[model samples]
Target: MALSIRQKRVRRISGDPVDGVVVQGPVDGLATGTPLYSVAVQGTIDGRTTCRPRGWRFGTWNVGTLTGRSLEVVEELQRRMVDVAALQEVRWKGEGTRFVGAKGGRYKLWWKGDDGTGGVGVMVREELLEQ
Candidate 1:
């Protein structure tokens, strides 16, 4: 005997109209247990409505310690154009935000840890700080 499996179909629901925009229907070919939907944004740029997609690079790493190698880590991340990163095992005591890297390429490090042995941190490119 052969086993048969059935996949659940995701139903598309119409969202309430906002700013004269009505979002309806689901994207095709992305059927899964959870429903996935996309939104179309119409923004005015100098009296023009434009729709564009923005992208960013992300990374994750378990740095042994950030005591003396913080700058090095920032340099590597910049070289790879990583917009945001989730770091583990930072090994830095206390929680605070600090600037790292050289003049041209800089990143803000937000870290939190009780002791100096285990911690987590997030590094974001300086250019995207305001956003």
Candidate 2:
């Protein structure tokens, strides 16, 4: 099933209602280099609101021979309360999958990797899907 999402525009005190996808949970805790997209109207949502921090967490990992470094990212994210994460350059470091999987988040694993050079992985907590 496709989830619903909510989006608050830049500097807006309120969050605009979006259908089919809602942004919830802890976004503030997301790690650096997380791929956050500006919410776009998918099914015609009407609301006068702006984008603001919803306290959701995200992460991004630059993959390489950094098998030793993957854990570092997860550990750091844990410390920051990051609920979601994007791991870039994912290669031999199965640790990224394990880390996000262990978190038990409503995660999405994609292999946008380029021969272990410019790959990206994204992780999202299920709680954050609810607006």
Candidate 3:
């Protein structure tokens, strides 16, 4: 299934309709380097909105050997509210299957490794796909 996000513009105080301008774009970061397009629609200045110190967190970590720590690592990810993660030196040989987490969470794991030494993969929270 393919999912996308489209936002609608808010109304002005004077009850006037604002002009909406949409910008589309794509980014390539996969091993195949396939492009994924996204659209952003321009809207009125929602002056009422404000910024907060809290924000989304994403990063990469070296799991060393994720053999017996799959659940542990995933649970830690939940604790940190990690939206995206890139794993390195997983120490797992061969390409592993999708990572399943609590509450029906999931991830895709790909590795080109040698003898459980060095492996790399990007772990995307399944919810990220909805965006």
Candidate 4:
């Protein structure tokens, strides 16, 4: 699936004031309190396919489970400008940096689950990979 990202001006945002990473702007296509990768993934706000501005978004969430659908989550990552996302209960097997999504770019998932029950992982953005 191709990510519908409108590459506009880079909206730099810092995950937090203390972290000092530049992050700005909100996801245009997403609604308030909606699961980013839910059945409703796209919509027009004003006759334009909403796009993500460049920035660093950071957060943590309990995914409950993770698999192929993780690709959908990757879109959410870019859509939200999340530079790093710490996910719990991923329910994945083993551990490694598994590349995902259409960008051909990738995210690193270091996971450990007990028979697909409980797992943890952190996804880092491509631009900020070296760190």
Candidate number achieving the greatest TM-score relative to the actual structure: 1
Listed in order, each prediction's TM-score against the native is 0.62, 0.41, 0.52, 0.54
> Which portions of model 4 miss their true places by more than 4 Å?
1-55
Q: For residue 15, what is the lDDT in candidate 4?
A: 48
Assess candidate 3 and give its lDDT.
Answer: 0.56
lDDT of 2 by residue, 5-115 (tens): 343332222354543333442234333433433332333335544334345544455545444565565556566666666665666423344323355433434445445
Per-model root-mean-square deviation over C-alphas: 9.7, 9.6, 12.1, 12.6
Q: Which ten residues in a row have the lowest lDDT in candidate 3?
A: 25-34
**Model 3, residue 60: C-alpha shift (Å):** 1.4
lDDT, candidate 4, 1-131, per-residue tens? 45343322233334422222222222333222322221122223455554433345565667767776688778777777566777888888777666666664566656676777798888887667775
Off by over 4 Å in 3: 1-56
Q: Which digits, one per residue and each the tens of the lDDT, describe model 3 over residues 61-122?
A: 77777777777767766665665667777787777557557656665455557788888866
Candidate with best lDDT: 1
For model 1, what is the error of residue 82's alpha carbon versus the real structure, in angstroms, after optimal superposition? 0.1
Number of backbone collisions per candidate: 0, 33, 0, 9
- Clash tally for model 3: 0
Residue 67's lDDT within candidate 4 is 74
What stretches of model 1 exceed 4 Å from their correct place?
1-51
